[model samples]
Target: MAKADNIFNIRGRLGDFIFCQRNGKTYVKRYSGGFTKAATQNHPNIKVGQERFAQVSRYVKSLKQQLQPYLWRQKDGTFHNQLMATFLQIAKNETEKTFNELIHELDSYSSLSNKSLNKNSKIDPSTLLYDAKTNKLNLGIIPYELAVKYKGLFLEVATGWYGVNDGEIFLTESNRQYVKLDGQTKNEDQLVDFAPADDLDGQLPFVGLAVVYTDDATSESPHPVHTVMACFVETRNG
Candidate 1:
Protein backbone atom coordinates (compact mmCIF):
# COMPACT_ATOMS: atom_id res chain seq x y z
CA MET A 1 0.00 0.00 0.00
CA ALA A 2 1.11 3.55 -0.74
CA LYS A 3 -0.16 7.11 -0.19
CA ALA A 4 -2.26 8.50 -3.04
CA ASP A 5 -0.88 11.87 -4.18
CA ASN A 6 -2.91 11.98 -7.44
CA ILE A 7 -5.14 15.04 -7.86
CA PHE A 8 -8.16 12.85 -8.78
CA ASN A 9 -8.09 11.39 -5.24
CA ILE A 10 -9.74 8.22 -6.54
CA ARG A 11 -11.78 6.51 -3.82
CA GLY A 12 -12.78 3.19 -5.35
CA ARG A 13 -11.47 0.27 -7.33
CA LEU A 14 -9.57 1.20 -10.49
CA GLY A 15 -8.27 -1.89 -12.29
CA ASP A 16 -6.05 -3.89 -9.93
CA PHE A 17 -5.62 -1.00 -7.46
CA ILE A 18 -8.07 0.32 -4.87
CA PHE A 19 -7.95 3.97 -3.72
CA CYS A 20 -9.60 5.13 -0.50
CA GLN A 21 -9.31 7.86 2.13
CA ARG A 22 -8.36 6.94 5.67
CA ASN A 23 -7.55 9.48 8.47
CA GLY A 24 -8.06 12.33 5.93
CA LYS A 25 -5.27 10.92 3.76
CA THR A 26 -5.81 8.93 0.53
CA TYR A 27 -4.07 5.58 0.14
CA VAL A 28 -3.92 3.01 -2.67
CA LYS A 29 -3.43 -0.74 -2.53
CA ARG A 30 -3.75 -3.74 -4.80
CA TYR A 31 -7.35 -4.92 -4.81
CA SER A 32 -7.77 -8.43 -3.48
CA GLY A 33 -9.94 -10.25 -6.01
CA GLY A 34 -10.79 -12.90 -3.40
CA PHE A 35 -10.08 -16.61 -3.46
CA THR A 36 -10.67 -18.84 -6.44
CA LYS A 37 -12.89 -21.90 -6.32
CA ALA A 38 -9.81 -24.13 -6.62
CA ALA A 39 -8.07 -22.27 -3.80
CA THR A 40 -11.11 -22.43 -1.53
CA GLN A 41 -11.87 -26.07 -2.31
CA ASN A 42 -8.28 -27.02 -1.63
CA HIS A 43 -7.89 -25.05 1.60
CA PRO A 44 -8.83 -27.21 4.60
CA ASN A 45 -10.73 -24.54 6.53
CA ILE A 46 -12.35 -23.00 3.47
CA LYS A 47 -13.32 -26.39 2.11
CA VAL A 48 -15.20 -27.24 5.29
CA GLY A 49 -16.94 -23.89 5.20
CA GLN A 50 -17.90 -24.44 1.57
CA GLU A 51 -19.34 -27.89 2.31
CA ARG A 52 -21.37 -26.58 5.22
CA PHE A 53 -22.73 -23.68 3.16
CA ALA A 54 -23.78 -25.97 0.31
CA GLN A 55 -25.56 -28.34 2.66
CA VAL A 56 -27.37 -25.50 4.39
CA SER A 57 -28.38 -23.86 1.13
CA ARG A 58 -29.79 -27.09 -0.27
CA TYR A 59 -31.96 -27.78 2.77
CA VAL A 60 -33.10 -24.19 3.18
CA LYS A 61 -34.09 -23.85 -0.45
CA SER A 62 -36.14 -27.03 -0.39
CA LEU A 63 -38.00 -26.01 2.78
CA LYS A 64 -38.68 -22.47 1.60
CA GLN A 65 -40.13 -23.70 -1.66
CA GLN A 66 -42.36 -26.17 0.15
CA LEU A 67 -43.64 -23.42 2.44
CA GLN A 68 -43.90 -20.65 -0.18
CA PRO A 69 -47.58 -21.17 -0.95
CA TYR A 70 -48.48 -20.25 2.62
CA LEU A 71 -45.77 -17.66 3.30
CA TRP A 72 -45.93 -15.57 0.15
CA ARG A 73 -47.12 -12.46 2.00
CA GLN A 74 -44.79 -12.59 5.00
CA LYS A 75 -43.05 -9.19 5.40
CA ASP A 76 -40.03 -10.28 7.37
CA GLY A 77 -37.13 -10.27 4.90
CA THR A 78 -34.40 -11.59 7.20
CA PHE A 79 -36.17 -14.85 8.09
CA HIS A 80 -34.47 -16.81 5.36
CA ASN A 81 -31.04 -15.54 6.33
CA GLN A 82 -31.80 -16.32 9.95
CA LEU A 83 -32.90 -19.85 9.07
CA MET A 84 -29.83 -20.39 6.89
CA ALA A 85 -27.52 -19.28 9.68
CA THR A 86 -29.28 -21.63 12.08
CA PHE A 87 -29.01 -24.57 9.69
CA LEU A 88 -25.42 -23.74 8.90
CA GLN A 89 -24.57 -23.79 12.59
CA ILE A 90 -26.17 -27.22 12.87
CA ALA A 91 -24.41 -28.44 9.77
CA LYS A 92 -21.03 -27.35 11.09
CA ASN A 93 -21.41 -28.33 14.73
CA GLU A 94 -23.97 -31.15 14.85
CA THR A 95 -22.26 -33.74 12.71
CA GLU A 96 -24.25 -36.58 14.29
CA LYS A 97 -27.64 -35.15 13.35
CA THR A 98 -28.93 -36.02 9.90
CA PHE A 99 -30.42 -33.51 7.49
CA ASN A 100 -33.85 -34.98 8.27
CA GLU A 101 -33.32 -34.24 11.94
CA LEU A 102 -32.76 -30.62 11.10
CA ILE A 103 -36.06 -30.51 9.24
CA HIS A 104 -37.83 -32.29 12.09
CA GLU A 105 -36.60 -29.70 14.58
CA LEU A 106 -37.32 -26.66 12.39
CA ASP A 107 -40.50 -25.60 14.22
CA SER A 108 -38.64 -25.45 17.55
CA TYR A 109 -35.21 -24.23 16.46
CA SER A 110 -36.05 -21.89 13.55
CA SER A 111 -38.40 -18.97 12.90
CA LEU A 112 -41.22 -21.15 11.52
CA SER A 113 -43.49 -20.60 14.52
CA ASN A 114 -43.52 -16.86 13.88
CA LYS A 115 -44.82 -17.17 10.32
CA SER A 116 -48.57 -16.74 9.76
CA LEU A 117 -50.74 -16.01 6.74
CA ASN A 118 -53.27 -13.79 8.45
CA LYS A 119 -51.92 -12.16 11.57
CA ASN A 120 -54.83 -9.85 12.37
CA SER A 121 -57.73 -12.21 11.73
CA LYS A 122 -60.10 -13.04 14.57
CA ILE A 123 -60.70 -16.69 13.72
CA ASP A 124 -58.54 -19.30 15.41
CA PRO A 125 -56.46 -21.69 13.31
CA SER A 126 -56.99 -25.43 13.50
CA THR A 127 -54.46 -27.91 14.88
CA LEU A 128 -52.94 -31.05 13.30
CA LEU A 129 -52.52 -34.67 14.40
CA TYR A 130 -50.17 -37.18 12.75
CA ASP A 131 -50.68 -40.96 12.75
CA ALA A 132 -47.55 -42.99 12.16
CA LYS A 133 -49.37 -46.27 11.58
CA THR A 134 -51.66 -45.05 8.80
CA ASN A 135 -49.27 -42.52 7.21
CA LYS A 136 -52.04 -39.96 7.51
CA LEU A 137 -52.19 -36.42 8.86
CA ASN A 138 -55.42 -35.25 10.49
CA LEU A 139 -56.56 -31.62 10.58
CA GLY A 140 -58.46 -30.79 13.71
CA ILE A 141 -61.80 -28.97 13.67
CA ILE A 142 -61.98 -25.26 12.94
CA PRO A 143 -63.98 -23.35 15.53
CA TYR A 144 -67.57 -22.33 14.75
CA GLU A 145 -66.54 -18.69 15.22
CA LEU A 146 -64.59 -19.04 12.00
CA ALA A 147 -67.82 -20.01 10.16
CA VAL A 148 -69.86 -17.19 11.72
CA LYS A 149 -67.09 -14.76 10.96
CA TYR A 150 -66.85 -15.92 7.37
CA LYS A 151 -70.62 -15.99 6.74
CA GLY A 152 -70.91 -19.81 6.46
CA LEU A 153 -68.25 -20.20 3.83
CA PHE A 154 -66.30 -23.45 3.57
CA LEU A 155 -62.66 -23.55 4.62
CA GLU A 156 -60.17 -24.74 2.06
CA VAL A 157 -57.61 -26.70 4.05
CA ALA A 158 -54.53 -28.17 2.44
CA THR A 159 -51.66 -30.21 3.81
CA GLY A 160 -48.10 -30.44 2.56
CA TRP A 161 -45.32 -32.89 3.34
CA TYR A 162 -41.60 -32.48 2.87
CA GLY A 163 -39.34 -35.51 2.45
CA VAL A 164 -35.83 -34.55 3.46
CA ASN A 165 -34.23 -37.75 2.19
CA ASP A 166 -35.18 -37.01 -1.42
CA GLY A 167 -35.50 -33.24 -1.11
CA GLU A 168 -39.03 -33.46 -2.52
CA ILE A 169 -42.43 -32.06 -1.60
CA PHE A 170 -45.53 -34.32 -1.63
CA LEU A 171 -48.40 -31.89 -1.87
CA THR A 172 -50.86 -32.93 -4.55
CA GLU A 173 -54.44 -32.21 -5.57
CA SER A 174 -55.61 -35.27 -3.65
CA ASN A 175 -54.07 -33.86 -0.50
CA ARG A 176 -56.48 -30.89 -0.45
CA GLN A 177 -59.76 -31.15 1.48
CA TYR A 178 -62.46 -28.61 2.26
CA VAL A 179 -64.23 -28.35 5.60
CA LYS A 180 -67.72 -26.86 5.64
CA LEU A 181 -68.05 -23.98 8.10
CA ASP A 182 -71.79 -23.67 8.61
CA GLY A 183 -72.69 -20.96 11.10
CA GLN A 184 -75.40 -23.14 12.74
CA THR A 185 -73.00 -25.86 13.80
CA LYS A 186 -71.18 -25.60 17.11
CA ASN A 187 -67.94 -26.74 15.49
CA GLU A 188 -66.74 -28.33 12.28
CA ASP A 189 -66.17 -31.92 13.39
CA GLN A 190 -65.22 -33.35 9.99
CA LEU A 191 -61.55 -34.27 10.16
CA VAL A 192 -59.54 -33.30 7.08
CA ASP A 193 -57.09 -35.95 5.96
CA PHE A 194 -53.83 -36.05 3.96
CA ALA A 195 -52.20 -39.30 3.03
CA PRO A 196 -48.67 -39.63 1.74
CA ALA A 197 -47.53 -42.38 -0.60
CA ASP A 198 -45.91 -45.52 0.74
CA ASP A 199 -42.72 -44.57 -1.06
CA LEU A 200 -42.23 -41.83 1.56
CA ASP A 201 -41.76 -44.45 4.26
CA GLY A 202 -38.53 -44.26 6.23
CA GLN A 203 -38.18 -40.55 5.31
CA LEU A 204 -38.48 -37.55 7.58
CA PRO A 205 -41.92 -35.95 7.36
CA PHE A 206 -42.43 -32.21 7.80
CA VAL A 207 -46.10 -31.23 7.59
CA GLY A 208 -47.66 -27.81 7.16
CA LEU A 209 -51.17 -26.35 6.89
CA ALA A 210 -52.74 -23.85 4.48
CA VAL A 211 -56.28 -22.65 5.12
CA VAL A 212 -58.28 -20.05 3.22
CA TYR A 213 -61.91 -19.12 2.72
CA THR A 214 -63.78 -20.22 -0.39
CA ASP A 215 -64.42 -17.64 -3.11
CA ASP A 216 -68.19 -17.71 -2.65
CA ALA A 217 -68.03 -16.60 0.98
CA THR A 218 -70.26 -13.63 1.72
CA SER A 219 -68.20 -12.19 4.54
CA GLU A 220 -67.39 -8.50 4.17
CA SER A 221 -64.16 -8.61 6.06
CA PRO A 222 -60.42 -9.22 5.99
CA HIS A 223 -60.95 -12.93 5.15
CA PRO A 224 -58.06 -14.38 7.09
CA VAL A 225 -55.90 -17.14 5.67
CA HIS A 226 -54.21 -19.36 8.24
CA THR A 227 -50.92 -20.98 7.32
CA VAL A 228 -48.99 -22.89 9.93
CA MET A 229 -46.29 -25.48 10.41
CA ALA A 230 -48.00 -28.47 12.01
CA CYS A 231 -45.20 -30.81 13.08
CA PHE A 232 -42.01 -32.50 11.99
CA VAL A 233 -42.18 -36.23 12.56
CA GLU A 234 -39.39 -38.73 12.91
CA THR A 235 -38.36 -40.98 10.02
CA ARG A 236 -40.76 -43.93 10.20
CA ASN A 237 -40.42 -47.31 8.53
CA GLY A 238 -43.23 -49.70 7.74
Candidate 2:
Protein backbone atom coordinates (compact mmCIF):
# COMPACT_ATOMS: atom_id res chain seq x y z
CA MET A 1 0.00 0.00 0.00
CA ALA A 2 1.68 3.16 -1.18
CA LYS A 3 0.73 6.62 0.07
CA ALA A 4 -0.27 9.48 -2.26
CA ASP A 5 3.10 11.15 -1.75
CA ASN A 6 4.98 7.98 -2.64
CA ILE A 7 2.90 7.60 -5.78
CA PHE A 8 3.71 11.13 -6.85
CA ASN A 9 7.39 10.40 -6.44
CA ILE A 10 7.15 7.26 -8.57
CA ARG A 11 5.31 9.11 -11.34
CA GLY A 12 7.75 12.01 -11.34
CA ARG A 13 10.74 9.67 -11.68
CA LEU A 14 9.27 7.17 -14.18
CA GLY A 15 7.89 9.92 -16.52
CA ASP A 16 4.56 8.21 -17.28
CA PHE A 17 3.22 9.02 -13.78
CA ILE A 18 0.30 6.62 -14.14
CA PHE A 19 -0.58 3.13 -15.25
CA CYS A 20 -3.28 2.09 -17.70
CA GLN A 21 -5.62 -0.86 -18.04
CA ARG A 22 -4.70 -3.96 -20.04
CA ASN A 23 -6.70 -2.77 -23.08
CA GLY A 24 -5.27 0.77 -22.76
CA LYS A 25 -8.80 2.16 -22.50
CA THR A 26 -8.86 2.85 -18.78
CA TYR A 27 -6.62 4.76 -16.42
CA VAL A 28 -5.35 3.82 -12.96
CA LYS A 29 -4.16 5.89 -10.03
CA ARG A 30 -0.69 7.33 -9.56
CA TYR A 31 -0.46 5.76 -6.13
CA SER A 32 -2.31 3.07 -4.20
CA GLY A 33 -5.46 5.18 -4.13
CA GLY A 34 -8.55 3.08 -4.89
CA PHE A 35 -6.35 0.30 -6.33
CA THR A 36 -7.68 -2.35 -3.92
CA LYS A 37 -11.22 -1.04 -4.23
CA ALA A 38 -11.10 -1.06 -8.03
CA ALA A 39 -9.71 -4.58 -8.12
CA THR A 40 -12.49 -5.86 -5.84
CA GLN A 41 -15.24 -4.40 -8.02
CA ASN A 42 -17.21 -6.86 -10.13
CA HIS A 43 -16.77 -4.71 -13.23
CA PRO A 44 -14.43 -6.26 -15.76
CA ASN A 45 -13.06 -2.84 -16.64
CA ILE A 46 -12.87 0.34 -14.59
CA LYS A 47 -10.88 3.61 -14.51
CA VAL A 48 -9.78 4.65 -11.07
CA GLY A 49 -8.96 8.16 -9.87
CA GLN A 50 -9.36 9.91 -13.16
CA GLU A 51 -8.35 13.41 -12.02
CA ARG A 52 -4.84 12.59 -10.82
CA PHE A 53 -4.21 10.21 -13.69
CA ALA A 54 -5.07 12.87 -16.24
CA GLN A 55 -2.69 15.38 -14.64
CA VAL A 56 0.24 12.96 -14.86
CA SER A 57 -0.63 11.89 -18.40
CA ARG A 58 -0.81 15.45 -19.66
CA TYR A 59 2.49 16.35 -18.01
CA VAL A 60 4.25 13.37 -19.59
CA LYS A 61 2.88 14.16 -23.04
CA SER A 62 4.02 17.75 -22.81
CA LEU A 63 7.46 16.73 -21.60
CA LYS A 64 7.88 14.44 -24.60
CA GLN A 65 7.04 17.21 -27.02
CA GLN A 66 9.40 19.60 -25.28
CA LEU A 67 12.27 17.16 -25.55
CA GLN A 68 11.62 16.17 -29.18
CA PRO A 69 14.03 18.62 -30.78
CA TYR A 70 16.95 17.70 -28.54
CA LEU A 71 16.25 14.00 -29.02
CA TRP A 72 16.33 14.45 -32.78
CA ARG A 73 19.79 15.97 -32.57
CA GLN A 74 21.30 12.71 -31.28
CA LYS A 75 23.19 10.35 -33.58
CA ASP A 76 20.10 8.14 -33.78
CA GLY A 77 18.23 11.18 -35.05
CA THR A 78 19.00 13.86 -37.65
CA PHE A 79 22.67 13.67 -36.67
CA HIS A 80 22.73 10.17 -38.22
CA ASN A 81 23.92 11.83 -41.38
CA GLN A 82 27.07 12.89 -39.59
CA LEU A 83 27.48 9.48 -37.94
CA MET A 84 27.31 7.79 -41.32
CA ALA A 85 30.01 10.08 -42.66
CA THR A 86 32.27 9.10 -39.80
CA PHE A 87 31.45 5.42 -40.22
CA LEU A 88 32.56 5.54 -43.86
CA GLN A 89 35.97 6.87 -42.85
CA ILE A 90 36.42 4.08 -40.28
CA ALA A 91 35.16 1.40 -42.66
CA LYS A 92 37.72 2.44 -45.26
CA ASN A 93 40.50 1.81 -42.76
CA GLU A 94 39.11 -1.63 -41.80
CA THR A 95 38.66 -2.61 -45.44
CA GLU A 96 42.35 -2.06 -46.09
CA LYS A 97 43.29 -4.41 -43.26
CA THR A 98 40.89 -7.09 -44.46
CA PHE A 99 42.28 -6.75 -47.98
CA ASN A 100 45.83 -7.30 -46.84
CA GLU A 101 44.94 -10.41 -44.86
CA LEU A 102 42.96 -11.91 -47.75
CA ILE A 103 45.83 -11.25 -50.16
CA HIS A 104 48.33 -13.09 -47.96
CA GLU A 105 46.01 -16.09 -47.53
CA LEU A 106 45.26 -16.29 -51.27
CA ASP A 107 48.96 -16.05 -52.14
CA SER A 108 49.78 -18.99 -49.86
CA TYR A 109 46.96 -21.11 -51.38
CA SER A 110 48.02 -20.22 -54.93
CA SER A 111 51.63 -21.11 -54.21
CA LEU A 112 50.67 -24.60 -53.01
CA SER A 113 48.39 -25.19 -56.03
CA ASN A 114 51.22 -24.42 -58.46
CA LYS A 115 53.86 -26.48 -56.64
CA SER A 116 53.76 -29.33 -59.28
CA LEU A 117 54.93 -26.92 -62.03
CA ASN A 118 58.10 -26.06 -60.00
CA LYS A 119 57.78 -22.38 -61.04
CA ASN A 120 57.12 -19.21 -59.05
CA SER A 121 54.19 -17.07 -60.20
CA LYS A 122 53.34 -13.47 -59.28
CA ILE A 123 49.73 -13.52 -58.11
CA ASP A 124 49.25 -9.70 -58.08
CA PRO A 125 48.19 -9.41 -54.45
CA SER A 126 47.47 -5.71 -55.00
CA THR A 127 44.81 -6.42 -57.66
CA LEU A 128 43.14 -9.09 -55.51
CA LEU A 129 43.22 -6.82 -52.46
CA TYR A 130 41.73 -3.95 -54.48
CA ASP A 131 38.87 -6.10 -55.83
CA ALA A 132 37.99 -7.54 -52.41
CA LYS A 133 38.28 -4.16 -50.76
CA THR A 134 35.92 -2.60 -53.29
CA ASN A 135 33.31 -5.33 -52.83
CA LYS A 136 33.36 -5.06 -49.02
CA LEU A 137 33.29 -1.27 -49.16
CA ASN A 138 30.15 -1.39 -51.30
CA LEU A 139 28.56 -3.94 -48.99
CA GLY A 140 29.42 -1.85 -45.95
CA ILE A 141 27.42 1.06 -47.36
CA ILE A 142 24.17 -0.90 -47.12
CA PRO A 143 24.48 -1.46 -43.35
CA TYR A 144 25.43 2.19 -42.77
CA GLU A 145 22.35 3.34 -44.64
CA LEU A 146 20.21 0.84 -42.80
CA ALA A 147 21.59 1.92 -39.44
CA VAL A 148 20.73 5.52 -40.30
CA LYS A 149 17.25 4.62 -41.48
CA TYR A 150 16.23 2.20 -38.72
CA LYS A 151 18.05 4.11 -35.95
CA GLY A 152 17.37 2.16 -32.74
CA LEU A 153 15.68 -1.04 -33.86
CA PHE A 154 17.41 -4.39 -33.36
CA LEU A 155 18.72 -5.35 -36.78
CA GLU A 156 20.81 -8.39 -37.57
CA VAL A 157 22.99 -7.93 -40.67
CA ALA A 158 24.36 -11.18 -42.05
CA THR A 159 25.88 -11.91 -45.43
CA GLY A 160 23.80 -11.60 -48.64
CA TRP A 161 20.76 -9.48 -49.49
CA TYR A 162 18.14 -8.72 -46.83
CA GLY A 163 14.99 -6.61 -46.45
CA VAL A 164 13.50 -3.88 -44.26
CA ASN A 165 9.92 -3.69 -43.05
CA ASP A 166 7.81 -1.49 -40.78
CA GLY A 167 10.27 -1.46 -37.86
CA GLU A 168 12.20 -4.64 -38.52
CA ILE A 169 15.01 -5.61 -40.86
CA PHE A 170 14.97 -9.20 -42.13
CA LEU A 171 18.23 -10.93 -42.87
CA THR A 172 19.80 -14.35 -42.86
CA GLU A 173 21.58 -15.51 -39.73
CA SER A 174 25.32 -15.94 -39.78
CA ASN A 175 24.86 -19.70 -39.38
CA ARG A 176 22.17 -19.87 -42.14
CA GLN A 177 19.48 -20.59 -39.56
CA TYR A 178 15.87 -19.39 -39.55
CA VAL A 179 14.88 -15.80 -38.67
CA LYS A 180 13.07 -14.94 -35.48
CA LEU A 181 11.17 -11.82 -34.53
CA ASP A 182 10.75 -10.69 -30.92
CA GLY A 183 9.59 -14.29 -30.26
CA GLN A 184 7.83 -15.85 -33.26
CA THR A 185 9.81 -17.65 -35.95
CA LYS A 186 9.57 -16.78 -39.62
CA ASN A 187 10.70 -18.10 -42.97
CA GLU A 188 14.32 -19.03 -43.40
CA ASP A 189 16.94 -16.95 -45.17
CA GLN A 190 15.03 -17.17 -48.47
CA LEU A 191 12.37 -14.68 -47.40
CA VAL A 192 15.00 -12.11 -46.45
CA ASP A 193 16.47 -12.26 -49.96
CA PHE A 194 13.13 -11.13 -51.44
CA ALA A 195 11.90 -8.81 -48.66
CA PRO A 196 10.86 -5.32 -49.69
CA ALA A 197 12.78 -2.14 -48.91
CA ASP A 198 11.40 0.31 -46.40
CA ASP A 199 9.97 3.53 -47.84
CA LEU A 200 12.40 6.03 -46.34
CA ASP A 201 10.49 9.05 -47.70
CA GLY A 202 7.56 8.32 -45.45
CA GLN A 203 7.59 8.49 -41.64
CA LEU A 204 11.08 7.58 -40.51
CA PRO A 205 11.27 5.19 -37.57
CA PHE A 206 12.35 7.16 -34.48
CA VAL A 207 13.05 5.01 -31.46
CA GLY A 208 14.67 5.98 -28.19
CA LEU A 209 18.27 6.91 -28.92
CA ALA A 210 19.51 6.39 -25.38
CA VAL A 211 18.16 5.85 -21.90
CA VAL A 212 19.88 8.00 -19.27
CA TYR A 213 19.56 7.20 -15.59
CA THR A 214 21.37 8.24 -12.44
CA ASP A 215 23.78 5.78 -10.88
CA ASP A 216 23.10 7.10 -7.39
CA ALA A 217 24.14 3.95 -5.63
CA THR A 218 27.67 3.89 -7.10
CA SER A 219 28.45 7.60 -6.88
CA GLU A 220 31.58 8.40 -4.84
CA SER A 221 31.22 12.16 -5.06
CA PRO A 222 28.51 14.65 -5.88
CA HIS A 223 28.56 14.50 -9.67
CA PRO A 224 26.01 14.57 -12.47
CA VAL A 225 24.29 11.24 -11.86
CA HIS A 226 23.08 10.57 -15.38
CA THR A 227 24.58 8.11 -17.87
CA VAL A 228 23.28 7.23 -21.33
CA MET A 229 23.65 4.23 -23.63
CA ALA A 230 22.81 4.74 -27.29
CA CYS A 231 21.24 1.93 -29.26
CA PHE A 232 22.37 1.35 -32.85
CA VAL A 233 21.84 -1.27 -35.56
CA GLU A 234 22.86 -2.49 -39.02
CA THR A 235 20.23 -3.52 -41.53
CA ARG A 236 20.38 -5.12 -44.96
CA ASN A 237 18.61 -2.26 -46.71
CA GLY A 238 20.46 0.90 -47.61
The candidate maximizing TM-score is: 1
Report the C-alpha lDDT of model 1 over 164-232, residue by residue, as the tens digit.
Answer: 345443333224456655644554344445556554544334443323555332222232233222334
Report, for every candidate in turn, its global Cα lDDT versus the true structure.
0.52, 0.26
Estimate the TM-score for candidate 2.
0.15
* Span of 10 residues, lowest total lDDT, candidate 1: 216-225
| C-alpha RMSD of candidate 1 | 7.6
lDDT of 2 by residue, 11-98 (tens): 2223434544333243435443444664665444333323323433443344234333223222233233333333333334444343
In model 2, the worst 10-residue window by lDDT is: 121-130
Runs of candidate 1 with Cα error greater than 4 angstroms are 1-47, 68-79, 96-127, 133-136, 141-154, 164-174, 181-190, 204-206, 215-238
As a TM-score, model 1 comes out at: 0.49
- The regions of model 2 sitting more than 4 angstroms off are 1-85, 91-207, 212-226, 236-238
RMSD to truth, every model: 7.6, 26.6
TM-score of each: 0.49, 0.15
Clashing pairs in 2: none
